[model samples]
Target chain A: MKPIELTEAQVKSRRSRNIAIALICVGLVVMFYLITIVKLGPSILNRAL
Target chain B: MSVINDHDPVTEIYISSAMPGDFFALLKPRVMSLVVFTALVGMMAAPGEIDPVLGVIAILCIAIGAGASGALNMWYDADIDAVMSRTKSRPIPSGAISKSEALGFGLILSAFSVAILGLAVNWFAAGLLAFTIFFYAVIYSMWLKRATPQNIVIGGAAGAFPPMIGWAVVTGGVSLESVILFAIIFIWTPPHFWALALFKSDDYKLAEIPMLPIVAGEASTKKQILAYSILLAPLGVAPWLLGFASIAYGVIATVFGAAFLWFAWRVYKMDEADRKMLPAKKMFGFSILYLFVLYAALLVESLLPKLLNLIGIA
Candidate 1:
């Protein structure tokens, strides 16, 4: 098997993605409890109609 | 204290093996049943028709999302789980699954549940499912949980989402009826959970979980439980008065609400040393029965009209 290596930047990037995922989960509960809607935004068809 | 001794020769490592227990635990099966039952009520009682297939898909996605949340909770709380006798046997704590593995599994399932619901059902329902998982795993886990005694008060939003998700699946939008359903759970959660917190005060304190009873003491917790119960009883009857449900539901709600208040009153009046485990213990046991019966009544009342219509008997 080949030795696996990741540069410092790559490791940092991976960790950043993990943090984003964690934050997204946290945001969900906060949004619900606050009753805030981060609208997915209106669709093009809905705008046209 | 370790649920699994890491250095023991017989100690197991769950490298990649899958067990039935892991999957069941992930589904948060007990929680899922309540979610499914409430979701069914929301869908059935909604004004318009959702195709049976779409409705089924929506509920399935919600169930999967709930499980994903459960898995993430187990992954993060593994250390605390090991210390709490009540949670020590969980898959993560018991060494049947590694924390990293559980986290990855949860992330994958959350993504899958959301994506499938979006594609097969609608973006609205899918979005709700995605949010529910995030709320339970992240907000309830990393944010409010350790940070505040009001953890469950805010975290109960996770439990409240199923009705909205169910409603969105059918209506593809939000409405008053679903909001009422949401409110019922929101109010119910504090009392229901605080009752447990009442008896599990030491466990919470030891785990540093910041449960209200642990931080505030029994009398204050009992008072809070009663206050929430007061809010809950009226809120429980709101669905019927607001026209989301019928008199049948209203009557049942009134009866259960009265009994719930009585139980909470019993809890509030008892002194800590005057009884067995404490007033909180009795309140805790009755509260579970109260929620189950209340939701079951909601399901029955919502379904009765349709069941009657189907047979041409109404």
Candidate 2:
């Protein structure tokens, strides 16, 4: 099989998309943490034996 | 992913590399946005509480499942999409993505979304998501799309499932409220699609897809559009009458529902001499607004008291 090369536009598009996905994932993590805190209140920090 | 047979020279030559953007495009983000919005409304309208984190997860699963359906649709419709001008630039037709790649992406996402929803949320919602993906990809895309003029009417069920799934995520089962939401979209779809078919008949003809306008005569299509619109107008206000929504929503639904009927009526009476089918175009555009505004009103009705209480105003 011959090796396939990505065009310049394809490379740029892929890079930008990866960046966007990364950003969205980070945002979701932070939002999840905050929502847990809001929902659980003081219990979030209360790790009992 | 089912690999396309590499017998065609064009496929071998043009499809050198696919970007992540192409895979994303296969997901049809615009359609996914609408699904997310409606599903979020469904969750809000449900009587029970969903933990915010779980709510987010449910929404994510629904969105991913919607994207899976879109990708699979693109995979299956690639041949017709290549011929239709409106779809000619889609990722698969444009050679930005391969059919096999899209099929794989859709399948993986479908499994992941369903599995995660089942594990993290309720299996009922997960089951609905799985069925929705299958219904759209297999039932709508593979079977109904080319088989009959009433394709949109049946295929519309796939689009109508998100809200029901959302409600199930909160309530752990389907309810009258969710079914009403489902009915609103299911009934609204025929007129919405037929209006577009009026103007895009040539595209359908070229693609050989038997859309209502292409299969039925234009006058017949127009009559059916008007009939569905009449049914839709009354159904739009069913929630308010059934006490699922407030009176304010009833008034808004009634006014917008009347406007929707007016547009459909104009389409019905439009002259063939009016080649642009402006009435049909107007009806199509307004139909989208009609669904969006009605759902937004319902969402506001559901969320307002909670929001006010959160802010100490209620």
Candidate 3:
């Protein structure tokens, strides 16, 4: 069995795409956090103990 | 990779060379910018208070939804796009991204945008956003584009939805004011696209798409452009007339709307033998400016009072 090999250009492009995906994932997490805070407001902290 | 058995010979291993920029291009950034601007105006003009954060989220979702539709359009229109010179360099047409990839991207974004908008803003706006994506992707790109010369006329509804969606984000329902905003864009689209069609009739002809100029001839297209411009002129000023916008906006809309009509009339009077198509070209340029100026005026009118109040000067 032989292992598949990627060209340098392919590797670079794949890396860049992975980084972009990572950044988007991070951004979405931040966005969801902000949305939760905005929607819940101070009342979120005032919930029953 | 495993060595192929003797029975099955190995062909070629597909390695994607597609960069992130190629995928970004699939979103049609120019169209997304217009969607963002119009939706922002809609949000601002609505008579309700919205948290700035929520408003930003709503705009982001709408823009993403619009981008998704653009990706779907690109995926479906790749073949014709390859034929048309203006669109030949698009990601799909240029082979930077595969059609299936584009379709998957569009579908994923569409779902995310609609769902997030629903959860964050309100269901009504989300529903409108979903319908807009469906209209652009399925109704316009797949059906109307190939089947009829009136594609842009009816399909313009998809573009007109953003402002209404924005308004919905604040009001949670449609109103006369929002409908007027929708009408302005709806009426403005035909003249804008037809002006481009007049200059690029050959491209539409080559792609076998039934644009008005390609199917109904330039004379009829010009008449239709002028007719739409006439309708749009009053409609652009309707917000002012209806008392939503101030007199300043009214005056701005009236002046810009008149200019739009003037450009359309110039296009209408352009001679068939005029090889330069200068009038049509200028109309196309002015049409974009006209819509932008009208929307920008509305946006400024909506935001200025708020800014003034914040500065303790209102």
Candidate 4:
């Protein structure tokens, strides 16, 4: 099968969108981790079976 | 080596050339900022302490939820937006983003914001945020906007929910104080939007939107604006009356509210031949300032003592 060619503008926009999504994902990860720590505090290490 | 079918229709594929800024524009950043400010005041006014990080998360979620609704509203209103001069340059109307993409973006963000708020904060606040999105996207944008002259009156509830949601973020419940905050914005909406509709009536008429000025004549719309301004004046001072804000805020609210009335009265007395609609325009500008100053005063009042004690200044 032949590949579908993308224009430079399209490729550039896609790259920027991907980078934005990646940054947002990283931010969300850090936020979730901080929230977990804030909510649980040192008790996060005291999980019961 | 197969025979070509000449009768088959050609299908077009869409590739997004939208930048991150376009997507951000879809969020309606100006409106989101107002939501953030009001919600922050609500959080500060509520009687409790919250972890700084969690408080930030709550505000972020509420802002995202508000933006999600804006995206959905733009998606649904793209047709009217394209016709209206004021909104013709919006992301969807400008062809920077497609309707389906906006819908997808709104839905995903709505779910994520609600889920994150519920997990990170209290469920009550998340529920309020979810209701706000639903009210704006479905109830206001889809149903009320094109249907009635009273649209902004009922639809204004969506905008007023942010403070209550903010109060819930810290307090885990609602109170008379939060409800008063909600009422101030709710009553303020009619006069604020009617002023814009007075000058922009031609836009609404062209777009076939049933704004007050387009549906009810300008004279009747002016009367309604005046009446709402009268109601809004005292409602703006309720935070002080309820003992939530100090006398300084009371004085500020009274002064701003009276100025709001003066502008509304000017709009009421404006001549039919006055093509400038200057009074209406001034009223719109002053109304925004009124809300911002009132909320900023409340926020400072709530935080000042704590801040002073923190620095040993009190």
Candidate 5:
């Protein structure tokens, strides 16, 4: 059987995609987290008194 | 500054290789946003008033501190990120930004954030922000990450400090309210991250990262997810019970907490072949909503009492 060798471009492309996804996940979590922070902080100010 | 700058060949090359996208990626804007928001909540929930200027300064310093951590994490994780399918295209890995540049960016920002927070806000707030940065970049990245699968479990606290620091920024000291906020995030971190791990186990395995799903089989990871969800319900309501919120908010918290546990239960009950793994996906989606709604409700509750007082009803 012949060995299936990957080109450098293929390997690099595959790796870059993973990073994009990771960055994306990080972004999603942060977006909600911030929305909560901004949304809640002022409300807390009014209610906690 | 010119829109036509892209017409120049030099500018074209720069844009392709070193875009603002690349630099913003280093800030880990996603991570920074969370730090900022939680800190904002802390500031609002704290018992005293903060000067608007000081509050803004504190948030900015924390943002920079978080960005600094992201840069440093990129510097260290560049190697692993280069290998994994989820992180390979990052600037360093993609040959866009050099490793030294990322490290220098991280270190400079770290010092800048800590110094600014100390000088502009209180030293205590600055000190806490500084530690949060160190915990994320040094403790979590340099040590716990590769050394243990429990990395996020312990390291998650680094991200949880923003509210505490924010509370300090307003009140000039740590309080129970901020600590409860921290606990909510800390508990949520495991299950939230574990959901990602459940779906992306192959990526972590490829990167040689010891995320729970990679080290333990799916069944064990699922069990742990249920366990965390079970603990998360009551913890979610801690802020309300401690006099940090009101009865209306308390009721909302209970409903939201129950819904989150239900989603976890669905995920737990799924058989391996359940409809292309919809259960995990549902759990993941609801998990995001669970945190957002939880915080949103807190914010709403915070304001409701004031609104009532203003209307001469409270």
Candidate 6:
């Protein structure tokens, strides 16, 4: 019947967890970029024709 | 929400106020870490090269799939989990999340992981991910877990498939080397869990899960643990013998495998009156380290050559 309110500790824990997930997602994006560079090299941007 | 008669199911509560941590807990992060590590080692060990992006994508899918299975397992085992002391504080049992919500979360992640993997990588790896999820969630959790003492023995396959799937991501198919990796984990699992079961027999008894120690008794369980450890010893070194790993890895595997057996032997020789189950507890702790160190060795074996080549040392 009423909106559920999170305790202060619960809110703090939730914030930290969301931040951790966000950081991991960012790390994955950075890794993908580095991997693309290592894999493709200078030839990546070259015209095939 | 409404209350029901004692015989009827609890009225379905639609409270969706679950915290972020609760949802993450549903993913079983500890188990997902092992799946990710093994799958990474598998991909690295494969002979051919894979696009770095594709490799990362595959690993992500594998991790998510593992988490999906974990959530589903929690959903199905919630009742027993509530009864078991070790699992009584889990997200569902602790009321951090509801069963229906967990089921929905697991199914969505399962489908998402498989579909993304298929589209971004090869279909074979995707299929393996799907099967692994299904095996753990359906075959293992829903059926085998409650049906017999051999539940973990067969259900362990669900855990073992990650490395093979990792190999498939790179090689596009299975091979002797990948199968060997699968076998090592497969063989390692029984002794590992049975050691835990030895100490946690009361939990299994209370939950009525029919674990080997409960069904076949402690002495029999200890003997089986030793037998499996003996089998695991040689199998751990198979990658080195098969020429994929270096002599150094072979030596490490041999030493770890031997130590694993020594622990198993200790567990077997432990007295029944030894209610502390010190040997079984020791074996259980060491088993986690054993797998971690062995996989770390394999990962080094896969990476060392490249590192040496980069430095012009080999």
A6 Cα displacement, candidate 4 (Å): 1.3
The sequence of per-residue lDDT tens digits that candidate 1 reaches over residues A1-49 is 2233455654665566566668758955564333222222233236444
Model 4 misplaced regions, further than 4 Å: B1-11
Q: What is the TM-score of chain A in candidate 2?
A: 0.87
Q: Given candidate 1, what's the lDDT at residue A23?
A: 78
Q: Write the per-residue lDDT of candidate 5 for residues B8-107, one digit (tens) a residue.
A: 5542332223444576788888778877877887777777776665677678888988998999999999989998877887788998777887898899
TM-score of each prediction:
0.80, 0.88, 0.96, 0.96, 0.78, 0.86
lDDT for B24 in candidate 2 is 78
Candidate 1 lDDT over B1-314, as tens digits, reads 12444454432432234454565675568888888877777777677776565576677778878888988998888889888888888887787667887888899889988987787667998888888888989999978999999999999999998888888887899998889888888889998888777767778888889898777878898899889999999999998899877788888889989998998898888777753656667777777777777777777776777789989999
Error of 4 at B43 (Å): 0.3
lDDT tens per residue, model 4, A1-49: 3234567887888899999999999999999899989999999999887
Interface RMSD of each: 13.9, 7.1, 3.4, 7.4, 15.7, 8.3
lDDT of 6: 0.90
Instruction: Tell me how far the alpha carbon of residue B20 in candidate 2 is from the true structure, in angstroms, after superposition.
Output: 1.8
Q: How good is the docking of model 1, as DockQ?
A: 0.03
Candidate 5's C-alpha runs over 4 A off are A1-49, B1-17, B273-275, B303-314
Clashing pairs for predicted structure model 3, backbone only: A4-B1
DockQ score of the complex predicted as candidate 6: 0.14
- Which order, best to worst by lDDT? 4, 3, 2, 6, 5, 1
Which model, 1 or 3, shows the larger TM-score?
3
Worst 10 residues of 6 chain B by lDDT: B8-17
lDDT of 6 at A47: 64
- In candidate 3 chain A, what residue range of length 10 has the lowest lDDT sum? A1-10
lDDT of 6 at B96: 83
**lDDT (C-alpha, whole model) for all candidates:** 0.78, 0.90, 0.93, 0.94, 0.79, 0.90
Q: Residue by residue across B1-314, what tens digits does model 6's lDDT show?
A: 23445554333425345777788899999999999999999999999888777788889999999999999999999999999999999999998888998999899989988987887778999999999999999999999999999999999999999999999999889999999999999998999999999999999999999899999999999999999999999999999999999899999999999999999999999999999999999999999999999889999888888899889999
